[model samples]
Target: MEEGRSSKGGVKKEYKGGITPFVVGVSIVAATGGLVFGYDNGIAGGVTSMDPFLRKFFRATYRKMHQEEARSSAYCKFNSQILTTFTSSLYIAGLIASMVASPLTRLYGRKPSILVGGLSVLVGAAINGGALNVGMLIAGRIMLGIGIGFADQAVPLYLSEMAPKQIRGALNMGFQLFVSVGGLSASLTNYGTDKIQNWGWRLSLALAAVPAGILTLGSLWLPETPNSLMETQGPEKARAMLQRIRGTLDVEEELSDMMEATKTSEMVKHPLYNMLQRKYRPQLVMAVAIPMFQQLTGINAIVFYAPVLFRTIGFQTNASLMSAVILGVVGLAATVVSMIAVDRYGRRLLFLQGGLQMFVCQVIVAIILATKFDSSGDGSISKGYAYLLLVMICIYVVGFAWSWGPLGWLVPSEIFSLEVRSIGQSIVVAVNLLFTFAIAQGFLAMLCHFKYGIFLFFAGWVFLMTLFVYLFLPETKNIGIEEMNSVWTEHWFWKRFVNQEFHIPIGIKTSSNT
Candidate 1:
């Protein structure tokens, strides 16, 4: 086995590169987008819980109703629709921006795309924090969505290109790790400001600006991805960038691989048209499926309706809020674990591991809630059942954070080429938000009507997610971004994943053109 150690698989066996501090630093700066992403995610749900902001912007129904809906059915339905719109506005805007993200990234390059995202969030946070009415809040939500769209689309693409195969999985997940951190920060800030009355939620949301501003300014000094420079600029600039980012003069071999890949990438006569050809169809399907399943896993349903779920399971208002904050902490911890172990353990293993655990967790949660969380005739779930439900939900969050949360972003970026990278990401990420929007808009109704049945729905999705990964997606652990077409187009590719013992023949020719 002159191919080195035949004893192992993935990035470890293929790459012997050491981690560079400069690359790590740049990654940290770019990943601040995840922080803002997470912060906004947590903050939006929590803001409605703050009495002062809710009363002011939402016109005191939250206060008058005592955290419950109005007695009038018509008014309640109208109010619920409006409130749902406010929360989903960001995601709606995200869908709009995602449609155009590919072309924008192509035009501006990844760095500028990220800069636009950061500035958009900065403006959004300012508007929401100072809003006097629901209209202003919705407007701010749109900007936030647009901003996050830019960051989410570009950050993963940038990391996948800049990072070596050895650290690619781990480095790409850095965004997810920081997202958990940002979420945790929002939870803590909410807890800290819980007693500050009306303006507390405003202050909590405004804090998202801090990270946005930091990423926007810090990214100015980051080196553009060599892949991007190679395709758009030229070899000399690409080589210089490789030297700076990798901290090496010995980049000749690496440069050769990228150059060859870039040539193959530009072989396309028409970008979108060529991307839809038979050879590219499989990656396109996977690109769409990964993000869609990530949302369909019902994690957002849990997040958007946490208080209602907690209260339904018998938690007091204070206890429910506290539970959300604790869940945020647990999720952040799990994401950190993913960042450390992703490259070491390989992507598919973690994905399969998480799927198994999440499936089981959902089953248990459904059983517990179904059997134990009966209302006490006063609309409160029994205390014992509430506590039991809490434990199960924590376990559920752990499973998601470790797997889909990080990998959802990482996978799409890896599976596409430079030619369609931006647009491909735009399509998938937009689909992700669309799934998110559907869940956000419909979840409360699901909660009111289905109760424990909602967890069961998630459990069913876990089964499909697990099977999809196992049967369809191959182990792309150490595969270079440029070599992806070869992997997808290999003969008997389905068997490669199924048998696990079969390796592609060394001299086999790729039939991507066929």
Candidate 2:
């Protein structure tokens, strides 16, 4: 394998060749999971805001939305429990389903989990399109949630494993990029279908199946990741695949490291229990904190409720849907910026910069709304201020799309060794979905009570999470996936928790090993 030395004199493996087309194609196909995730996020708000959709299953909410006096309680008009539950149930079910995906991913391989997720989404979309009642709507959403849980849990791991260390961050971010594309697709679909007087929402929900079907079929052709192969199919097949993936015959050094890690992992029957060991404290903390903090950023709250938010601020239904389309477009573009820049500028810089940008935008938006818009008066925001609010929200989306949106999945997927990787990913998915459910369920109520102050509340979280990264997170650029243990052991703080004895046999010529 190619090699390099850190400033501290630790040896590191660096892949030397250019990334092959085979890997790129595989990574793109695997990232369809993000599309499914993005579509749901984008579709929910637009569908809910549609008059026909609201009239059919949420008549009370529809009437409240259309009433003259509804302006008096702008944020409270959409506060129906059933309505929010329709949106939140998928996340809760996803949270549960992710926990179930942990072992299955380890046993059957990443492709299977992705395929199952896609199939579940396919069925869920069909059910949702044909739903006859609220119960059927929720049931369909639950199936969709299960599908997302599985896909979200496995896709990041699959991408991380398959990508060469040189562009792992960029490749992994492809998942988030597709997520943006899916959201954009959903927003565009919602805009077009809103004109269909009676069943526009049905079409919006059904189109989710198109991407899900692609993922399901695409997964059938995916090569099992080398890391997964090593763990489950022995070293010979793992080496063969690694060589094929790398487009090189000189994969012995990397394959040897994979074999060593897999051999150690084989002795651990329960990765969940193993994760609780003191040595894994860093991984454990990150798996919980990263995903939890990602949700706390309040990006999802905006994505999930953008149409409602714009309408609450006095935009027309078509205007609200169109505004969501704007946010999706901006987000998709920003994610492309991240994909191109992440490896060059590094993850920590993006996180810090994006955090500062989002925090500033949120505070400014809150200030503008609090000072200029009279919440107690029965009037919509002025045209200039309405567009201004949309501008600030778009900036906020840019900040998140480039930073937390992708790194939350990338960092967690890369940190864990072969043994705990699957379970570690499960924790990430579960925590992310749990807080996502909480935000979807509570955001409307919080908006009603807190009003503009809700933005300030998220600003506080953004501050704390930024500080957490500045203090605790180590820069992981250029590190091989299997060699991540070195990063923790070298960090000034985390080193105390990492067992000095712990090492991956990657031919590192450290003085101690020598």
Per-candidate TM equals 0.89, 0.97
Against the hidden true structure, what lDDT does model 1 obtain?
0.75
RMSD of 1: 4.5
lDDT tens per residue, model 1, 89-201: 88978888876777777766789889888899999999988888899989998999999888888888888888888788888999899888888787777777776765777
Candidate 2, TM-score vs. the true structure? 0.97
lDDT of each: 0.75, 0.90
> What clash count goes with each model?
2, 0
- For model 2, residues 225-326, the per-residue Cα lDDT tens digits are 998888778888888888888899788878877887888788899899999999999999999999999999999889999988988888898889999999
Please report the TM-score between candidate 1 and the true structure: 0.89
Segments of candidate 1 deviating more than 4 angstroms: 1-17, 59-79, 267-270, 375-378, 490-514
